[model samples]
Target chain A: MKRIESLTNQWVKETKKLHKKKYRDITNQYILEGEHSVQEALENNGLIDCVITTDDGLLKYKSILSKVSEEQLVVVTDGILKQLSELPTPQEIIAIMKKSEELTGFGEKILVLDHVQDPGNVGTMIRTADAAGFDQVILSEGCVDVYQSKVQRALQGSQFHVSIVTNVALDKWIEQAKMRHILTVATALDDTAMSFKELQLTESIAIIMGNEGQGVSSDVLLHVDKKVYIPMKGQAESLNVAVAAGIVMFHF
Target chain B: MKRIESLTNQWVKETKKLHKKKYRDITNQYILEGEHSVQEALENNGLIDCVITTDDGLLKYKSILSKVSEEQLVVVTDGILKQLSELPTPQEIIAIMKKSEELTGFGEKILVLDHVQDPGNVGTMIRTADAAGFDQVILSEGCVDVYQSKVQRALQGSQFHVSIVTNVALDKWIEQAKMRHILTVATALDDTAMSFKELQLTESIAIIMGNEGQGVSSDVLLHVDKKVYIPMKGQAESLNVAVAAGIVMFHF
Candidate 1:
């Protein structure tokens, strides 16, 4: 077994750099923390660059270690693990998994996000979309980077289960979706917008959710096939974007 | 107008103390910040002890100041304002408002939370409950204090518009709700938990949401009339608590 006790080890330096988005983008891999998320990735055949664990972590996650290649495992000192960790209390196990390549195909159901800036919201939406059985989640250029740590935490390993592609042109995708007979729905509150319940079900569909404060962006709103609003019965002006997406995603 | 320049001044000290739950409970008041939340409290006739603003804030919110009593307004230095503020960038205006007294009567639609500890989730749930036009939100003792700053921000001023009562015994409340013929639904994924869609609609309902990591507590689960789970077609283990709450709340 190889043991790394120094923080200045070449692998340690490289793994620490993975905390930043720039480094993550360049390496095409991101640091995944926590036992559950790491285990999910391993089980789902996610690309694993390597696994890092403390001495105690090796024993604690012995079952996890049994599944991975011994050559790919690196045992580190507790101090070294703390330096590589992002959480206040570092989990015993951490994994570096390659970012999944952007998917070209689409399923019957799709979700498009327009400039939704919050990391937690972006992750929750992906998790929700996956639960609702959406085929893919396409992010517009203005959306937050999905590789952000808060996003990965909020996703709770759902990122491995779902197809999440970033930097897509939403207007162009809406046109493509329409051509494929997928009903594109934008959540808006305009007078012409029908209640979400009033919309007729379709075999193929796409839903567009917008920023926290702003509804769907104007240009993207124009390309959608229909506009629907979740009828608000109380004084709240709008629902949280992720919740709104779940309600709409499940409604169909 | 009375002006406070020193952080040690009686009002400044008291306002700063409001950030902690201990002082907030003893004084029966909590700090409300930003234009939206303060304005919501003003419009809804929330119990406002005093309004604190910087000179620029007073000028900017002149329309808001006109509605309150002159005696209740206090002008403070920007430096002092920053000390009293919780955000990275402090809002110009702040208000000290009394917490709403607990409600004795039950409403048609009630949302009960059992040990949902995340402040953001608790706040978002309250906002969603308001949007769904639920009559009230009852928080179990184990839940995070709703007056926490993060919860307040996530709520987006919905706190003033909704009836939110804390420290309630949920098991007892479920019994009362059942007597009123309000359908009691617990969100669980157990074998006996039917699909949320299978439940019959009722005139009134109370839905209990649980902690993020753990679903509804076992003891509380036994008191609910029915248990329903949101059907998941994809691989994600569970939906976010707030998203799950919105789906169940809107399903009715």
Candidate 2:
């Protein structure tokens, strides 16, 4: 393993920029930090570009060092890891992974998040989608970056479990789904919307969730097969987006 | 109309202590900060004890200004509100609300959160439970404070919508529920739990979720009617705690 002490190292600077979504898109790479996160990355070690960490991090995870090939290991300082991480306390190890080749139509169930701005919500949805065996999570163009550290960390390594594709035109998918007889359920607040429990079964479906402040976009809702809602006796207008996604995913 | 500018003001010093759970418990009052939160307390004026804010906060909420009795309104400086807020940009208004007296009776649908430590999770669960038309939320002895700023913010006024009793002895409630023929369903990972969607739900039920890291405590699990699991498909192993809760809640 070679030490990457030079702050001027082009790769170090480039990887650090991945902390920002703009940089991630430009470079097509994202950084995963923390021992647990790095280990999870290696556990699913199919598409990682390289593993970069401090000597101390290497020592800490030495047992799993054999997991990555020598050519893919890069040693750097803890200070460098801090510079690269979006975490308040930088993790000891960070791995650089190539965004999986954009995946589409991977399986029966897909989730479309509509302009959900919260990083934690996005992450939780991705993690839950993976756990519920959803084939893929398709995000509308304006949603939060899935590769952002907060989201990646929240995914709890589920990021690697499912295919996440973004910048989608949801209406086209909804049209296709309807043809396959998969009902597109858009959650709404109105009484006309049937209770979630009463929804008809669709083996193939796309449940669309909207933004934090607003319900699903009107355009997306218009294309859905049916409008549904989680009935509320309490005054809360709705559930958190992630929670809503979870409930819908599990039941669907 | 009086602006209490000095920290020496009796209300200012007393309000500062509301930041801690100890003081909130001892005083039997909790502070609601931010315009939206303060507005929530005001809208539910039956629960508010008093309010403190700058003139702007008072003026901004003029529509609801008459809701709080004039004496309950105590004007303060921005600095006071800042010191009272966990967030940097403290909202102009802050209110002191009396904690609702715990109600008696095991309702038709109850949610038991065991040792859920994240304020966000507790709050979001309360909101989700309310939206799913749950009867109440019971927090085990170790669950996070439901009155914390983040929880309050997450609930988005659902706190007033549902009955939440914290620090309850789980056994006592289990006994009470059993007498009422209420079933307990504990969410777990490895337990050969039936799918959450498949539960033979009794009219009266308790959906129990556990701590973020550890699933339901062994003691709690022992008492549940059945252990239930949300099916997962992707390679990821887990979903966020709140998401898991929503999944179970929606099923019933």
Per DockQ, the best of the predicted structures is 1
Q: What is the TM-score of each candidate against the true structure?
A: 0.97, 0.90
- Stretches off by above 4 angstroms in model 2 are A5-13, A104-107, A171-182, B7-10, B43-46, B171-181
- CAPRI tier of model 2: medium
Model 1 DockQ vs. reference: 0.91
> The CA-based lDDT of model 1 is what?
0.89
Fraction of native Cα contacts reproduced by each candidate: 0.94, 0.95
The residue pairs in collision within model 2 are A131-B232, A132-B232, A132-B233, A133-B233, A133-B234
Candidate 1 regions with alpha-carbon error over 4 angstroms: none
Residue-level lDDT tens digits of model 1 in A10-75: 988988888898998898989888888888989988888889898898889999988889888989
- The clash count for each model shown is 0, 5
Give one digit per residue, the lDDT tens place, for model 2 in A1-252: 667887788977777778788988887888777777777877886478888878887788887677878888988877777777777887677788888887666457878788888999898888888887787788888898888888888988877777788887777877877887776889887666888778877777778899988879988888887888876666777678888777777775
* Model 2 lDDT per residue over B3-37, tens place: 68887878778877888899989988887766676
**Model 1 lDDT tens row, B133-236:** 99789999889998888888888888877788898888788888889888888999899899999989888888999999898999888888999999999998
Worst 10 residues of 2 chain B by lDDT: B37-46
